[model samples]
Target: MKIAGRTFVVSGGASGLGQACVEEICRNGGNAAVFDLNEEKGAAVIAKLPSGAGKFFVCDVVETDSIAAAVKQTMEWVQETGKPLGGVIPAAGVGNPTTILDRNGDAFSMDTFDFVVNINLRGTIDLVRQCLVHLAKTEPVGADQERGVVIMVASVAAFDGQKGQISYAASKGAVASMTLPMTRDLARYGIRCVTIAPGIFESGMTAVMPEKLFKGLAAVMEFPRRAGQPQEFAQLVRQVIENGMLNGTVIRLDGGLRMPSKI
Candidate 1:
């Protein structure tokens, strides 16, 4: 589970939490296959990494063929770099604030609900499965015969779904709920599964929130009353990868923030 000399597949690696993870991995002497749709941002991220430490692949996680193609390209890059696939991080997600009934009392848009679910829930699972296809076949690396790890990103909203977060909460909750079962399914292959449920992190999803709402979220923090740095999230990701005992569970990266029902 060592980060050094290994390659990790990271979705949404072009920015925010995923970008921090990519930087952290490169700093620790590992390689990252960054799967993202933004070519410019992807290239910028790769440019900052150590030479040969990162590569970007254009991938839209909602598309099955896109993920397959990215995985193929990643393996080929892995071969070139001589780094074994060590982990997978499916961090690409989106959020939409929509109530069951609109301001005019109209029913919720099914299209909006579907779009959120498809990206946040289905997209994450698909990326992990696609990467696991190859990760399972890799040679086991340590005394535990561990092949790789999966670090999924969830949100505190999964547990504390305030008003207008039905779709977002459902998608993230499913991710947290699937951790144990997915781990069990992959255990024999020496692949571990764990999910991270973060609260009020400085991610793309939070950046667009109104100033008042953002401040309200900060007020809920028990200490260091502020948004979490992306690096802090990245630190936990590294810990999960190196610690063999962290499997089959969802770890909260929140700073003691359970999130109020109104926030």
Candidate 2:
């Protein structure tokens, strides 16, 4: 599908990789809805875009009411701008480090594990289901017969999970595993699904890390010897939307970095 004059909803668009997507969409002549809970940050992101290029919606992915309200607002925008909902990117997630056992060998907190799974896996599914409702209503765009696209953010942990990543890996693994089946299920409606399993990238989550720890993480990269940039992620998002044949697959955005057993 063409990026210009189209609309996309980006979860977690208030910061990090999602913010980059909102910026890139506007820069490429498309409009975006910044779906996030942080009103202040979301407004800031929208403010930087061209007027009418994007808007912010207060949304919590794990809450049904929040997501429903945001979708309603987005549909209103679609009507106002006369642009079809062409894509969605689910980039909201948490990565709190946890192990199955503590120093004293006590079992890990089940609450923490549940929280991670609920936000990362269940939240992503909810957002996609809601977006698909609107996307399916729109007519297909271009000769590719594409009604919309969904790009989910998985992680390298889904494959090469290390110590303290059990919950996070399980959540991301589900996201990656659903790509092909989601594509097949949505085939009749012409909506494509793809996943991006990113490696160590410079994001809000990583920004607070100490210099020594951050450098040590980047040291494992096989080439370029640095963390991936947010723009690079956004670039791939744009490419997937433009390239119709990229459906039903997971693309690893890591720089040839196979994470070790522990951090």
Could you tell me which 10 consecutive residues in candidate 1 have the lowest summed lDDT? 254-263
Error of 1 at 156 (Å): 0.6
Off by over 4 Å in 2: none
Whole-model lDDT, candidate 2? 0.92
lDDT of 1 by residue, 98-194 (tens): 8999889899989989998999999999999989989998999889999999999999988998888999999999999989999999999999999
Model 1: lDDT of residue 241 = 90
Backbone clash pairs for candidate 1 read: none
* Deviation of model 2 at 245, angstroms: 0.8
Clashes of each: 0, 0
Q: What is the overall TM-score of model 2 with all chains considered together?
A: 0.98
Instruction: Report the alpha-carbon TM-score of model 1 versus the true structure.
Output: 0.98
In candidate 2, position 38 carries an lDDT of 89
Specify the highest-lDDT model's number: 1
